[model samples]
Target: MEIEVVVPGGATIGEAPTWVAAEAALYWIDIKRPALYRLDPATGAQRSWPMPSDIGAFALTADPPGAVVALRTGLFRLDFASDKLDRLAPPPFDPKLFRFNEGACDINGRFWIGVMFDPLTEASPPLKSSMHSFTLAGGLRPEPDAAELHNGMAWSADNEIFYLSHSQRQAIFAYEFDPAAGRLGAPRLFASVPKDDGLPDGAAIDDLGGYWCALHGGGRLRRYKPSGAVDCDIALPVSQPTMCAFGGADLEDLYVTSASDQLMPEQRRREPLAGALLKLRPGVSGLARSYLVR
Candidate 1:
């Protein structure tokens, strides 16, 4: 599988790219700058939206013509057509202690979002952040357990398994997922990379049921089997590859997003493509795109 560069030169921290099949567009977020972008491959057209606060996660709703965003305060709706933003949930308790990070849509159209530990409260022991799931049923619940820095999240093809990452810890976890009940089982350590290796950020599942994850600081994207074995490694030009997803009509074009926000001056100088988006052509196709609950 050969990897190519796409949107080749700009992104501070690109994460969570969702494919909107109907419109043939890819929607992704840049957490550092807190902006949203829609890229149309056909015309190479890219449009961006500024967020009042950092966006942790968001997804395109299946019924409605907009996406749901998990913001610093709470959840809200972003109407792409009208370019309007509306609040969906009130600010959570301890609003200042947490902010949104990674988000994705599940098989049931629920949006799962992660929160980053507040930097202001460093003296406090590292708190275990939770992965929150929003259902069309209209309620928010912590899926199962808490993570130090919950990042990438995705479900298996049958929707029975879930994968999550703790970025700073350099580990990924797997759990049995029950979509109907919106519940998860106890997590077992999935895999961990050495400190010198890149940290796992965002990931997506392919049609073959394998998961492909971008190693944020590691400069590569790695694929894994359900058993947690490394199947393949695809290197990238950037060191901060944040997320990757399969888009394009055939679902074979692998689009990856990277970042530059936390790079040291020296590292940035060495890797000018640090924040650029990348594209790869893999041997396997990806699963169909999931939609968010309206």
Candidate 2:
């Protein structure tokens, strides 16, 4: 596949690529830079909103016509037009020790977010990160399991399984999901990466139950079958690919976000494309992501 550099300048920690079908634009965030960006693939037009604090992830909301943003401070609703932010919920953990990281909305429109210990801000041993589900009425509900660093978050094409990755542990887990009830069963080992290989960072699910995962620091994107077997592996130019999402008129174009943070000056010199937004045709369509409820 031919990899295209859609956005040349690298983001500090580029992540959470989400496709908005209605606008035909791709939305993403730069965590370290703390900004939200919208890119028009066809016209190469772009717009950005400066965030108040480190932004981990965001999901579009139909009713408010903006987004539910996950920031280091807490969760808030951002009105796209007014550029105003309204508090949705406070950070569950101490903001100094932990911060929100990866997140997305489920099929029922509930937002599922993960919290991770901020190594950049704290030097102590990392605390176990937790996952939470949020709704307009029910608010944030914490899940039982915890990981050192939570990253990948996606649902199977059928919505019968939930996929989550523990980047520090180099593992991706699968859980039986009940879309009607918004409940998760005990997690099973879905996939794991070797220590030499890159940790699984963020992921997207194709229509055929294939999970496309970006191997941060590995310089590759790997696709796995629903049965936990490797399907396809595509090499990437950047060594720190943080996330991938499917976009385009047919949803076959794969957009990847990479990170330029935490690299030494020499390393940065070696990786010119380290933080660029990349695109390629993966030859498979992806499922539409659900918008945040409320």
Candidate 3:
């Protein structure tokens, strides 16, 4: 597989690459820069919307034809055409202590979001964080488990399993998912990275049940089988790859987002593609992304 640079500029913390099949465009966020970006690969035209606060994740919505965004302040609905934002719900915890991080929509159209302690602003951040499920009618519902830093959030093609990563722990976990009930069973260790390999950041599930995960400090993307075995690993040009998603017409193109935040000047120079958006043909098709039901 050959990797190519799609977007060349550096983003502070590029993450949550979501492909909109309807528009044949890609949407992603720069967390620290606190902006939402949309890119049209065909035309090479990109657009951005300034966010009021740090944005963790967002899911395309079908009903209102916009996006449901998870920002540090709370969950909000953003009108893509008008650039209007309407608050959906407030953050479950105090925003000062915790902020939303990773999220995605399930097959049922319920948005699942993860919260993490903000170490950048808080002098002494706590290790505890939580995940929540949101719907237009049901609102936000917190999960029973906790983690240090929640990153990867995805569901199996069958919707019978959910995958998440605890970056601080360098582990990715799998849980039996009750999609009908929107509940999670006890987590089982799905995969782990050695200290030198780097922390598992964000991930996506392919149609064949392969979990493609981005290794932050390791500068690689690893595909893990559903049985928790490694199948393939691809080296990346940037050291801090934040997330990956499957796009392109057939959902065969893998787009990886990287981060340059908090890197020393010399370190940034060494990793020239540190915050670039990269694309590669992974030779596998991905499942269609579920949109928010609201």
Candidate 4:
């Protein structure tokens, strides 16, 4: 339950931490810098690839043999070796008005991403954001929800439930998911985190059906029981813990990403570890991630 800095990275806003077990590496994105970063835990080696535009999130594909990145303009398959980016599909909304925020793969290998208003510093207009579903074959499809600042993206152990967080709303929702049909039922109010605890951000589901979510700007990570009761809350050094994923060979190590963006000069001086990659052992194994099959 003790979290420590594993990588002293200075990402403007590090989000979308994904554990690529096949490569034995953790991948995350810096939203403002518009870059993709990789860190090898064993060797303490790190590298980065500059993105063509602001990349909010991405998915690792097995079929296409590269990263499926969600940029401000559209989704593309990025080839680092050749510096080639092939457009997979355009965003459902105009890039100037909205951008992808956080995403993850579903049980059936479909990529689910949430859109948010551009320039998150100001209040956003209603109906400007949405959740989109994509597949390598079908391209992009929009869901029924309109979210302002969508962040957390996670699925249940049985693949029967879907969890997503609305940061502005300070709430997380649960949907009856049909993996076979790739459909989501009406969302049910799952949990509304306390305001002082910080807004709900990235999340991960455990084998015990517990939901572990990072509290952005709260300097804490919390685990919610199945009944929506608080089970655990661990303090973190960074105030803006963006996202987290279970990594390591056994999938027990929880790797978290933080941000240094939007901090006051005095605040930055007080928290020097604001944008570092964090590692911790939660003593519970994570549910296997749904990989992109197409």
Model 4 TM-score is 0.95
Estimate candidate 4's alpha-carbon lDDT, on a 0 to 1 scale.
0.85
3-23: candidate 1 lDDT, tens digit per residue: 666676567778888777778
lDDT of 4 by residue, 159-253 (tens): 88888888888999998899887888988988998899898999998889889999998998899998778998989899999888888899999
If scored against the real structure, what TM-score would every candidate get? 0.93, 0.97, 0.96, 0.95
Clashing pairs in 4: none
Instruction: Return the number of clashes found in candidate 1.
Output: 3
For every candidate structure, what is the RMSD over all alpha carbons to the true structure, in angstroms?
Answer: 1.9, 1.2, 1.4, 1.8
Question: Per-residue lDDT tens digits of candidate 3, residues 1-294?
Answer: 689999985898999999988889999999888888899999889999889998988887775677888998999998888999999999887788778998888888888888778855646746686788888898888888787689888888888888989888888899999998888998899988788988899998899999999998889999999898999999988999989999999999999999998789999889888889999988899887775554
Q: Look at candidate 1 and tell me the lDDT of residue 199.
A: 82
Best candidate (score: lDDT): 2
The alpha-carbon deviation from the true structure for residue 157 of candidate 3, after best TM-score superposition, in angstroms, is 1.7
Candidate 3 stretches greater than 4 Å from native: 120-122
- Between candidates 3 and 4, the one scoring higher on TM-score is 3
**In model 2, what is the error at residue 98, expressed in angstroms?**
0.9
Least well predicted 10-residue stretch by lDDT in candidate 1: 118-127
lDDT of each: 0.80, 0.89, 0.87, 0.85
Superposed model 2: Cα runs more than 4 Å off: none
Error of 2 at 58 (Å): 0.7
